[model samples]
Target: MNASPQFRVLRSRATETHNNLREEILAALESIIFESYHNSFTIRADLEVAFAAEVQSKFAVAAHSGTMSLFLALRACDIGPGDEVITVANSDISTTGAISQCGAIPVLCDVLANDYTINTDLVERSITDKTRAIMPVDMHGHPANVKALRPLADHYNLRIVEDAALAAGACDYGLPVGAFADVTVFSFSPFKPLGSSGNGAMLVTNDEEICDKLRLLVGYGHDPLRHGVKDGYQNYTAEGYNVPLDALEAAVLSVKLPYLKEWTAKRRAIVAALQDGLAGAPARLPSFRPESAPTFRSYMICVDRQFEIYQGLRAAGIEAAFSYAPPIYQYSVYAGAFPNSNELKVTDRLAKELVNLPITPEFSDSDVEYMIETTKDLLEKT
Candidate 1:
């Protein structure tokens, strides 16, 4: 009998993306280094324009990271101390941390068991007089039902600062994930769907006034029309931080940007295969509403043996893990911090059962099959 052939390692990492785009990245960098004599701001400005158009937004400002983008978004909305921002607990610390950093309270909200996004129905009850904004996260590239919450937000006069860190290519309500938001932020971290070489984010908004505020905050609080005309004197608009996106990352991202739609389609195809392959498996797969067209940052499933399956996948050279588990409120830093933590029943349950499977555009059919077979085997036995 012939021996069985060994398959390639099934892992999702930014290195794979960078490796695939290495030549393009290098060429982009070379052009920036030798061909152009402009400052970092010039390339960054170009990226901002291109990215804004890609997402169908009127204006965009690239920032150092998604965290910075969120902070800037809230700041642009004038969120401050004693204000409250309603958001989900089953997300990266960045979601709530941005609100907290702005001296605003992060009011915890439960997520839906199916899509693992905020439960819009519960949002109104959480609203209080102090609430200034609603920051809904598109968890695991699943679009939060922001459209449903739009009326509630409008009624309360609250700003919608969407945290779409992992949802770079996802869409909802017949538009991009950020279309319904006052300000939407997309992350370009190494592990994100639209992975860049390093950390970067873009804040997009239709409101020019909000765009102006975001630019003022990212650009050292300098209003070009108001200050620095005298050459020696520079006036500040608002106390802001210098957190603009790096020019090199912008250049790399620009090369990758045009391919986003194609890449997103690839991600969706892989997930469809996984869903079909795992239909009989013990794990409960994620489900989205009909209108939501989510791009896979990572495919998540709820399983009883979360750790066992996670460890098994790792031992078998498949990268699987629990992301955003333990809920943010359960973190040591947030212990006793959120009074409403106990109300996040669904979020609490998801933290225990959710397992993220590696999904990337670089994944071949064999990689997808191996992962599916390995996970099903693990689920069957464990």
Candidate 2:
């Protein structure tokens, strides 16, 4: 009988990404520490410009986290008290929480069984006289069909705030994922595709009005009227929060941003290999539309025995995670908050079955092979 393969324990992808960029990150830090003295905002501003250019947006606002970016985007859209924003229930709490934070209601929309993104066809039906915005999450780095929702949002005079926290380098319809939304947010938390050492995010928009609102909200409502005045007097136009992106994190992200495309390509290749290796292996892989090009945060696969497979992978030294299951609406914190939760049949099914397998640019070809073989063995037993 053949002996079992000894696989290296895969830990955090973010750590590997950081280790890989150690030199560049150190150089950026050195420059910021010595040269940037008292001009810390300039580092963040440079990142915002580079990020905006990369995402093909007219303006970008850097924020402390993706959650804050979502909130700022919602506020920029004037979504508040009694307004309803349609979003999916299968995403992280940040998606729904952003809407609720603004005193607006989040109308739960179910996701597609295949891609696990918001079912855009059903989004319009959720719209009401009070519907103010549509927030679609690109769950597991799969690009939601925001392009389809663009016309719907325009017709309803609604705003689309895409939560692409996991999809910084993804593209859809031959353009970056944010191209179709009024404002799109990309996260730089360590676990994301293009990650910084600490929490950071960028909100990108083509609308000058929305851009101004985001800046105002991020800078403690510092008067945009006096933005070009050059005077040091602090003035306020509206009540807002101070949550600008951390300058040091911005420096790290600036060093990493140029390598995003390369890392994203590596992620896609890893998913491709996983897709080919796991085919017909008692697990269901996610499907994407031809126009969608996704960068995987982790390669998600659904199986009948999610927990068993997840545990088995961990035992075999693969860092498989069982999360986002049972749906967010089922969480105790949300108990009875979303009465329409029962209607999310597909979302419920996905949450119960999904398991995320780690994928990183640092993964070796042998590492991917080990993952495939080990997961296939686990799935076969289940």
Backbone clashes for every candidate come to 0, 0
Residues 188-229, candidate 1: write the lDDT tens digits. 987788977789999999999999899889888986644655
Tens digits of lDDT, candidate 2, 125-205: 788898899999999889999999999999999999999999999999999989999999999887788888779999999
TM-score of each: 0.94, 0.94
Off by over 4 Å in 1: 1-20, 37-39, 223-228, 340-342
Question: After superposition, which runs of candidate 2 have C-alpha atoms over 4 Å from their true positions?
Answer: 1-11, 223-232, 340-342
Residue clash pairs of candidate 1:
none
What lDDT score goes with residue 80 in model 2?
Answer: 92
Question: Ten consecutive residues with minimal summed lDDT in candidate 1?
Answer: 1-10
Clashing pairs for predicted structure model 2, backbone only:
none
